[model samples]
Target: MTQTVPRASATATPADALAAGIGFLRREQDRAGWWKGELATNVTMDAEDLLLRHFLGILTPQAAEESARWIRSQQRADGTWATFPGGPADLSTTVEAFVALRLAGDPADAPWLTPSAEFIRDQGGIEAARVFTRIWLALVGQWSWDDLPNLPPELVFLPSWFPLNVYDFACWARQTIVPLTVVSTLRPVRPLPFDVAELRTGKRPPKTRTPWTWDGMFQNLDTALHAYAKLPFNPIRKAALKQAAEWILARQEADGSWGGIQPPWVYSILALHLLGYPLDHPAVKAGIAGLDGFTIREETDQGWLRRLEACQSPVWDTALAMTALLDAGVSAGDEMLVRATDWLLGEEIRVPGDWTVRRPSLAPGGFAFEFANDGYPDTDDTAEVVLALRRMGKPDHLRIRGAVDRSVAWLEGMQSRDGGWGAFDADNTQVLTTKLSFCDFGAVIDPPSADVTAHVVEMLAAEGKTGTRECRRGVQWLLDHQEDDGSWFGRWGANYVYGTGAVVPALTAAGIPRSSPRVRRAVRWLAEHQNADGGWGEDLRSYRDREWAGRGDSTPSQTAWALLALLAAGERESEVVTRGVEWLCARQRPDGGWDEDKHTGTGFPGDFYLSYHLYRVVFPLSALGRYVRGGS
Candidate 1:
């Protein structure tokens, strides 16, 4: 069932580009029959890895030097590090990187530290950093524990129905904050190698006098919590800490990661170590070893460099790559695809995790982003994997049928009451916890998003489930959420480009005609926003400001996304389509793949961004293959 139709009157066949990209992707596939391109994030991960090692008293001289080298290499010309490349200088990232480099024995008087020190001080210094940054400072005895907002371990006692309960958080933040509660309660501080006075702005932050707002109320609440922390031991404190530890231990994946992400894995290990779990404890040892797998080392122009990734993305990359390959005419029955399907089938989650709390009666049947993480299976990844399976053209295969049916059922049950889908849980949209001062970084709750919902709807439509009530509800949600300008919000991806691109084709496949007024409006929006370079791009800033969405210097991946949307709307013969295709062709490298330095994959919108190395290559291939296939 591989698509092979070629468009007539084409300036040139995208077959060459598609074939070359496919061959490159084929070589990139692992021996286990899956693909995993590097999931690159910012220097914060590398800096934090060194900081974690320092806290555990296990940092080797060799390892420290290499990590410092990598951190220093990421420094921008203004001598500050950012959360993402080509983004603004981030105060928190600069502070962490500076502290890490100083711990690596980079001299206090080194010229490289001067500009960064100035940047931090001018930006309001260490006190102006995020709550998470302040927590790290407190860990190394650089900041006092009293300065941090309180997160009582007693929070473990809160039932699911209680306000600000653990279940209110998005899975990623929930895992990180749970252990943080334990750490904040213990308030352990290790001696530092040196003071960070040079990074300080020398100005005390003015206390807020406004009493009616989120900041004011959270400030008062934190004051009360802090007072409680100093009171005579309550009997529940012991039981609460014990509950927190047990909660963490129970969620450890088979690979030893808490949630297959850096923050939770690192914090959980630290929290346990403080509770007298030695470095060699089974859980502690496994957690540390699991983190090592996320490190990437390679030869750089300056020499060998080792960087740490915030998380791994095997299941995600494999699904996207498989679909792209099929679009490029790889036979559905190809041995490679069969092997991939077998691998994916083996990965289906049968045991419930945190997601079960939201949908207690829902059956276990979804996939996690990592090889482990059985505790949290995301709807986004599960939907994409189903699409990949369908693209493999195996309708009657027993294993595929079973996995798809279970996943579809899970998706149906996990849909938000709003008729959309969130990343992990059902109806996980509590805005109260996000108002807390400690949650100053990003969205703490996982609300239903346009992009994830679109993928699920698209998958169901492919399976002929569009006639069902569940699919109809999902379609309605997408229509309801469309922006005034016809774009949709991409909660998981970059911005409007990712969301609108995902929604158009999904709606088309779900029985909405491509020429429908709503669909045509979306098509017009994309056409009007096309960059002068004939491609499309969006900045990470778009997540913070609506004006920035669907606007930036052209990138291969975003261009491909727009092209796919246009193709879905029957615009394959349009001028915009040809120009977009040309833009991608002109940008392909001699390696038979595209070169995109922009970080297209979004981890947490404005706070964290990802440059999935394969996205630049994989998505472009899919676009070209579809172009050769005539249209979606």
Candidate 2:
């Protein structure tokens, strides 16, 4: 929707901004008692969605044309597509975008294809692309399974105690690799309408040295596994394949998705289909139905539109939206807040998941990222949900009370050995796993992170768990992990601005004095980093380079994050706070919200970025309200 705000007089205060932003947010809330904004990522999702539909023989001309239009419009003037906007051209994204366009009937001699294909050839061609891309190519007979790394289904049988077991992978990666094992073992290849040979460099890529470095060792292992597959089908191999099939079936979420993310849901469908599950089978049918929910269609200001979220974030979005509304002084027990509480309570996971392998005694009591994904209830979302419930001030409400108690217990159990919390599992910080076998993209293990841990600490403090041992330990962990520049590392969000934003507030809630040296240092870091335009922003590149941390074009979401941090640190009356609030007010549209073009959310650091559409609106509202109320 087009967002516009009333013109502010020279005497306009943060109060005026808060009212405008809140009004805009209230209008945008869904009728279902929750909010769900666009979770935008790269064009790869568009390209991959088309590829999956083609593989299943369900691609429609309309669907193809709509997706192709989105993909083509995203291409840079130089004819290369980037993984994130304004970032360098990525060969993998370019290749995928080019192939999707070709399938959509774009001519081989099309202006974009010529340069994109040349870019692919210049970047070492198909052989140099990431493993996941190569795997996708293999499915359509464009690349050979033999050229890809090996992922044995037998790995499914590895015990939790064993190194490199299936449980060692983060929940998302596990869901993806398990079903993938079936696809690679069967080696099924469905040829595409066109070949991409012209995109390839004539020469073969070099092999890793046999002596075995980190990546080289995996390469050698893959070579040995390849040779073993050629010998014969062993009884053990057949049993492993069966185990994999059952494993896939067992984790399917009640909403019909696997892991609540696109990668696994699509792969699971393909894997089950190859295992003889027909289109009409209940599991296959449900999986197909779930995919439709992730799709989004709307009319952009530029005209027609088509896109797919890499994943949904209803639970996460609802929790934050409720919190932002309440923080902006939405009445406690307000009908909308009450309804959101009911929906959140209904979504809680009652069954144990892979997390049980680590915390065997803990009862299930957390929330997932999407509407489904019972198998992976994340700590980040759980913490935020608990805080949102607390914000309602309904301690006497039985359902809210029950949920808070159970979720708090679950969060405590999920905490790592170091007193910090990882998003999914405890002690899942085995860094060596990243170099082992067929894992090349994104974080492989769920390790303890400062940002996630801080949220839990903040939640605990709010519940009067501040003096408790667990809370104290969590507070210390945050201090121990603080960077020299007084910033914390953002594991789930973008850069130092996100890390500092998250940690300072939690620390303040945990009884850290605003005058304390550490807190003061953090407040200073934020003040110093404010952009020339009186706002704050940080690029995804900060994940890789320390110098880029807390530096970028001003954005509403990141600006709000900074504003909240300053307020939490007792700097509400400071010049930086005033300037930050003014920046948000100046950018507000007539409809009472803000517009952001930069990708502020982080998925896999430099490899992936997100533009949370509601973030630009909700956060600024929350920040402005807190400023008007006189404290965080």
Q: Considering every candidate listed, which one attains the maximal lDDT?
A: 1
Query: How high is each candidate's TM-score?
Result: 0.97, 0.96
Task: Give Cα-based local distance difference scores for all models.
Answer: 0.87, 0.85
The lDDT, on a scale of 0 to 1, for candidate 1 is 0.87
What are the per-residue Cα lDDT tens digits for candidate 2 across 1-632?
A: 11233334445567777777668767777777777888889898899888988998889998898888888889999999987777779988888898889988999889878998888999999878888888888988999899888888988999998988888888888899899989998899878988999888877767586655777777788899888777675888888889999999999987789987888889999999999899899999999888788788777766566888888788888898888888788887777788788788888888899999999999999898888888889999999999998766564478888888999999988888898999999999877778865677788888888889999999999999999888999999999999998888887777788888899999999999989999999998988889877888887778778888888888889899999889999888888998888888887877777888888887776688888888898888888888888768
Could you tell me which 10 consecutive residues in candidate 2 have the lowest summed lDDT?
Answer: 1-10
After best superposition, candidate 2 residue 355: deviation in angstroms? 0.7
RMSD, every candidate, angstroms: 3.8, 2.5
Model 1 Cα displacement at 576 (Å)? 0.2
Give model 1's TM-score versus the native structure: 0.97
